[model samples]
Target: MATANTLERIFSVDYKSKIQPIVSLCIGGWGLENLSEPNEVTIDNSTGNIYVADSGNNCVKVFDCDGKIMFKFGDKEGKGKMYRPIGLAICRDRILISQSRNCILNYQVNGEFVSSIGKLGKGELEFINPLGLTFDESNGEVYICDYNDNRIQILSQELTYKAQFGQDNLHSPLDVKLTKEYIYILDGSNPCFHLYDYNLILHKSVISREHKLQVFIPFFFFIDNSNNILIITDYYSIAFLNSQLELIHRIPITQPNGVTVDNRGRVIVVCDGGEHHLNIF
Candidate 1:
């Protein structure tokens, strides 16, 4: 492969052990009655609570660290009405959801309606199909993936627009993660992910196929405690990469869609292709 300036190529990656699922979740009603289409999964850093955006069911399911179904919100009724909710992120005491609206809805830890962040527009403090999002807990900042707008917007903890980036190579971006050192964006385009600095400078685009892997469809990923990037691809596997963008390990999974890491660095994946259930390793 040619040595590109932004996206470099690697030939081989270390294949680590395939961690088995410690717990599998299938919590809901029954017989196509619950968890119709779960789009994303997130973990509460403070409490290790698992939040699943049950889109088809028009609700958000909360699970404890042990995979026990705690409670659910957003039943299309009151303040927690979730219309096709797709994304989820938990920072501190707040739960952020990106659903049918162009804005991001917020709720307290107890599932009480709190406030919203952006609106439906093309400008700052405005969003178009806002999808995955993450929080910079250290600096009280939120990084959101404005999917249709092809940009990533940064906002203060108070939901004030700070800055935005990725107008050049962000085509259908899905998830946005903010680590201690860099901003990881999963675009699902040619260059699957674009890693940038805090200032939104173009650092490098991490393409999954560069390593000659079978990652045809890259969905969601999260950074572990060791800063390793765990990516869930469409080919029933998880690719692990180091902070330097080098592939380190590949774990086998079963048609995983959304993935996150718990407080204990366990891999939590939501599989919809097979059983439409959630699994934790």
Candidate 2:
């Protein structure tokens, strides 16, 4: 929780110098090679390729920097089958997808199935509804937001369960983002963001309404290289926060669910409602 003085310090700064991120490129539609109800988006910084968890299409779509479809994997009824992939992350040369079936599927960079990671349960090595995940390049570990379980599960680079935290405070944790010094979580039920140290110690909690922001039910978020936080909300806008967690700007879109920053520091958003396309800013 934040004190009144803390809130005052956060809101005292002028946020009038708004950032206007134009839609430089809009890719995909409702057909094949297009995106439908995409839930998550990640960038391979090394290759500058974009990977989208195309939930409705039951596959992961990869596109080049120019919005050209490179390849897609995960069929409806065959090998590497996935149902409603809602979470995606890039771990070095491997890709991890968390589907609605309550398990994380591992794949190679070239779209080859490696193995299944977890199952449907509440015990160790299990998950109820894994939503958003991120790979920590500093430590080679995977952090997954176990939605229904109300916890953040830690896994090794090999996808083996290591530890879990946040069950006592997080309510419907939707997304997890990692910075070198902290771990950030977006909780849908609480409709707030929680900041924690790498040791899993809760440092602060921020509610959008407390700061006079119009963010309603943040669905997912991404932390950029500069430590700026870009949050996708159900209210048809993306809220931007500075490294100090101050509300800085808000970019309006249709209905965005996922957001990420590219290697070039461009903001990429995935609009799932009424606009099934990727908007690059």
- Top TM-score: which candidate number? 2
Q: Write candidate 2's Cα lDDT for 1-281 as tens digits.
A: 11100111121322233355445344446565788888888887669898889888888999887677889988556446899999888866888899999998889878889788888999987999999988876566888999999999999866788999999889999988776567888888858888898778998988866765546767888765344444455557888777766766877677788777665556677887665867777
lDDT tens per residue, model 1, 1-281:
11101101212322255467778766434333356678788877667788888877777888888877788877456545678888887767888898877878889877788776667888998989888887776666778889889999888878888998998879978887765566788887664778797667988876767754335677777765344444554547777766665666676766677787655656778877646778877
TM-score, cand. 1 vs. native: 0.85
Provide the TM-score for each candidate, comma-separated.
Answer: 0.85, 0.87
Strongest candidate by lDDT? 2
- What's the true lDDT of residue 89 in model 1? 73
